[model samples]
Target: MAVSHLPRTSGRLAIIAGAGALPHHVAEAARRQGEDPFIIALSREADADWSGFDHATLAIGDFAAISKAFAAEGIDRVVLSGAVRRRPDWRDIRPTLKTLAKVPSVLRTLVSGGDDAVLRMAMDLIEASGARVIGAHEVVPGLLADIGPIGEHTSTDDDLRDIEAGIAAANALGTLDVGQGAVAIGGRVVALEGAEGTDAMLARVAELKADGRVSSRRRGVLVKLCKPQQDERADLPSIGPSTVAGAEAAGLAGIAVEAGRALVLERPAVIETANRSGLFVLGIERNARERPR
Candidate 1:
C-alpha cells in the first residue's frame, strides 16, 4: 500500500473530535509519528471513549473555551475529524471576542446552507483562534483511498454501468451541496444521499428493495465521491466496515469512492468485510469523467 506524505509541522496538534473512529485513528497515527495530540472532544457529538488521552470535552459551540484551550496548549495545527450530528443552537454558543462578530454569519449558514458552508464557517472560526486547520488524511496518509480495487473482488461489467450512473448522480447531488453519495442499480439511480447521511440512505435502499420498489435481482452499487466544490481539508467522503455492512444489507454488489479524494477508514477491515460478503470495493480515479461504454 503506497501512502502519501504531508509536510510535518512543528508544535502541538489538536484533534477537534466529533462522532466516530476517525479522530481516534488520527490521534494514534500522531502518536506513532511521536507527537502527543491534545484532543478537544465535542460533548454529545463525540461518542468515542477518550479516557487514555489527554483531552477536554467541550460543547460544539463553546468557542470561548476552545480558543482558551488552543492558546493554553500552544496548538499550531488542528485536524477536524468525524461527524457533527446537528447544528449548534444560538443559545448554546459561547463566543470569544475574536469570533463574536462572525457568530451571526455562522448562525445564518447553519440555518440556510448546506454542511459544506457550515464547515467553512467552523474552519474560519478555528483559524481566527490562531491555529491552522489540516485534513485528517494529512495526519494519517494511509487513510486515503488508493486507485483500483482494495478488496479481493473487482467490479463486473454490469457493475461498471451502475458505478458510472452512481458517479454521475453523486456529482449532480454534490453540485447542489446536498450530499456526496448515490446508489445506482441497473444503470439507473435509486437514491441520493441527503442530510440523513450515507447510512440512512443505504437503510432506505434496503427498505425500498424489501418493498419491491427497486430491482432485487440485479444488485446495485453505492458510490461516494467528493462534492464538486468540497473542501478536501474537512469532510472528504468516507467509508468503513459499517459501510460494507450497509451495502450488503442493501443488496449492493459493490462500492466505489473517489481515489485520493476520499477516506477509507480501517481499510483492512473494510476490505475484509467486503470480501467476505462478496462485494467489490474499488477506488476510481478522482477526475473520472469518461463514462464506461
Candidate 2:
C-alpha cells in the first residue's frame, strides 16, 4: 500500500523506532511527504526493514547516544513509536560523559517507576536537549482510527453487549496500568490483556476457546482503548491486520477500538481482512456516562 502524504513539518524529523511496523509506517509517511525523516532504530526491537531509510541503529540503554545521533542529524523534532517491551537495565546503560550528568535521575526513574512515568521522563530528557517530541499521529494523521464500523459487518446485539463488557473490563485493568485490551464473550469478560500485550491476550483466548473455557457460540469481541490515565502520546492502543487475524483466530465476533484515540494501521488491509475472516472491526466512543468510577 502507498504511504499517505501529510503536511510537512518545519524541522527535521527523527523517528525513535522500537518494535513492529509502526516505525516503518511513520518513516514512509515522512519520506513520501518530503520530510526526509532520519530514523533512530533501536537494536533491541526495531526491524531490519528500516534499512531503506536514513537511520542509525542503537541500543535502548544508550540514551545519551540516541540524543547525539539526533543532534548529529540536525533533528529538531522527534516521534516515538512501536513497543519497547521493557526499559534497559541500569547495568546495560552506558551514558556518554556529556549524558552522564542526567544518568542518575534517569536511571532512578527506570529502576522504580510506572511505565507512563518512565516514558514521560524519557521525553523530558530529549526535549531538554532542544528537540521537540511529537506523537506518531502528528506525522501521519491517517493512521488514527476513525469512528464507527470499518467494514461491511455491523455489530450484532450480542456483540454490542460483549463490547461494552470488554470496555468496562479493559478500563478497570487500565487503571492499574495493566493493559489496554480485553476480550468479552457472551457479555462476560473472558480475558484482560496484561503485561504481554493484545496479541498475547488473544492467544490466551484461543486457548480458552479450544478448552471450552469460553463459549464459542456467538464469538467474542476484542476491545482496545486508551487508558483514561494514560499519557495518550506514548501508548495509545493500536490495531492492524495482524490484530484482525488474532481476533479471528480467537473466534472473536469483532474488534472494537476507541475512535480517534486508537491507531488503525494498514487501514484498507485491516478492513478487508476483517471482512474476509467474517469479523467486524468497529471504532467506538466509550460513553462518558459509562466510565468506571
Candidate 3:
C-alpha cells in the first residue's frame, strides 16, 4: 500500500529499531503522517539517536520487557527496521506467557535456520504478543526503487551480461536462504554473498582483483534481489551510498536490484555517488520463473 493512503488507526505505532539509518527514516515518515511513533530501540543493535522520539532502549532478548513496554505505550502496530548485528543469546531470552511455549522451537531456528526462517519466527512471536507486525516500506513507500537507471550512468551491453549472471547466482543463493546478493564479472558468476553480507562480498571481489585472480580489465555488476520465499515486510534487499563506494572500489561497472522488491536507501546520495564514481545503478524486473524456492 502507498504511504499516503495508509489507513489511520487509533492505536500507536511502535518501531522495533535495530542498526543503521532505516529506523530513523521510518520514524520520520511516521511523524510526517501525523503519528507519534514510540521507538523500541534494541540495545547495542540500534545505533541511531532516538532521543528526539518517545523511546526506550532494551535488550533484544528481553521479550518480557518489550511486551510490557508495548502495552504501556498502547502500541498495537509494530514495524521492524534496520540490521541486527547479532542473534540474542538463548539464556538471555525472557519470554512472556504467550511466547514461552514456542521458545524452544524459536531458539532451535535461531541456532540452525537461515535468516528468512529466523525472521519469520520473530514476526510470529511479535504477533502472538497482540501487536500487528508491518513492513518498513508500509511506513515509507517512497524509498522503494523504481525501474531503470537511478543515476547519470547506464549499464553497457557487457554490463547487462554480468547483471544477468549476477541475478541467476543471487536467486539461487536466496533459494538456499543464504543471502540476497551476488557479483558477476565478464558474464560469469564470481562471488555469492554469504553471512558476511553484500559489502564484505564486494570487498572480497576487490581483494581478488588486487591479487590478479579476477581480471581487472573487465568490470562487473552487483545484483541484489529478494528471496523467493521472502517476507516483504522485513529484510528487503537494500543499497545506499556506501554500496556505490564499495562497487567503485571493487571496480564494478554498475549495480542492479529487483525494481519493486528492493529498497534504495538515501536515493539522492546514492545517485550522486554513483554518478561521481562513474557507476550505474539500475533497477531491473525479476523473472518469476528464475526464482525457485
Candidate 4:
C-alpha cells in the first residue's frame, strides 16, 4: 500500500544495511541517540554482526519482500547505506501488482543509466512503496569530513594547484553523470573515476605511474566532490581508509573531499593510513575553492 505522506521521523528506523562498517555504525550511532534501528540486512552483502538488532534478510532485488518487511515491522523510514556493487539483475526482480506497475521504468533504469540515475531509480522504487529513503549521513552525523587538511602531511603550493585542477575535473565528470572523482598531477587531470569506483580508478593511476606515464616531478591528488546537480540527501561521494591505501599505491600526493558533503568512514584509520603512507588528506570548502587562494 502507498503511504499518504512520508513521516518526518520514523518511530523506529529500518536500516536497509548493505556491505561495510557503515551499516553497523549507523545502527550503533542511532541506538546511542535512543533511536534504535531495525536491521534489514541484504543477503550476502551485509555482515553477520547485526545479530542483536530487530532484523531480517532479503535480496537486493526483492522489492516486494522489502516493502512487506517494512510494513510488517511498522517501519516508517528507510535508510539506504553501503556498497551495492552490481545493479539488480532483471531476472532477479520478483514483481507484485504494485511493483509490476513500476516495471516499465524499472526495466529502463536497470539497463540504461549511470550510477546516480540508477540509484535515484532504486530509491524511487522504495519510496513508491510508502517508505522514505534518506542518506546514511542523517543517521551517522560524524561520518562527514571536516574542513581543512587532516593527517600528518600538509598541502604544499604545488599540491594546492593540483587539488584545484582535480576539483574542476571532478565537477565536469559529475555533470555528465560519469563519476565523483578525478586525479590531477601538477595542474592537469591524469585520470577520471568511473563505475569501477575510486579504488579501481586509483589502481589505473598506479598502473600509469608504473609505466612512467605520470609526471616524475610530483604525484597527483585525488579529488572527490559532490556532483554539481546531485541529490545530496540520497547520494554523496565517500572516501575511507581503503581510499587512502589506494591513493598511496597510486603514488598520489594527497586526497581531498568536499567538506560537510562527502562521507568518510573509519576516519581515525583513514588519517592513520594517510599519515603512515605520507599522503595528505583534506576536506575542501566549495565556496573557498571558487575564489583564488
Lowest summed lDDT across 10 adjacent residues in model 3 is found at: 284-293
Residue 84 C-alpha lDDT in model 1: 91
lDDT of 4 by residue, 1-293 (tens): 11122234645688888777777877887777677788889887887588889889999888889888878887777788777776777788765668658645877777787778777777778877877777677766577877777787878888888888998888889889888899999798999988788889999999888888886567889999988788765567888899999998888888989887888888889989988999989888754654222
Residue ranges of candidate 2 with Cα displaced over 4 Å: 1-10, 95-105, 288-293
Would you give me the overall lDDT of model 1? 0.88
lDDT tens digits by residue: candidate 2, 1-293: 12343355566899889998788987897777678889888887887487687888888877778878877888888888898886777787766655556544777777886677677777777776778887778778588777778888878877888888998998887787778999999899988887788899899999998998777676989999888787666777999899999999998989989887888988889989988998989888876333221
Ranking of predictions according to TM-score: 1, 3, 2, 4
**Cα lDDT computed for each candidate against the true fold:** 0.88, 0.81, 0.87, 0.80
Q: Which stretches of candidate 4 lie over 4 Å from their true place?
A: 1-10, 47-49, 99-104, 287-293
Misplaced by over 4 Å in model 3 are 1-4, 102-104, 288-293
* Structural similarity to truth (TM-score) of each candidate: 0.94, 0.91, 0.93, 0.87
Q: Residue 152 in model 3: shift from native, Å?
A: 2.3
Clashes of 4: 0
Candidate topping lDDT: 1
lDDT, residue 98, model 2: 54
What is the lDDT, from 0 to 100, of the residue 123 in candidate 3? 81
Best by TM-score: 1
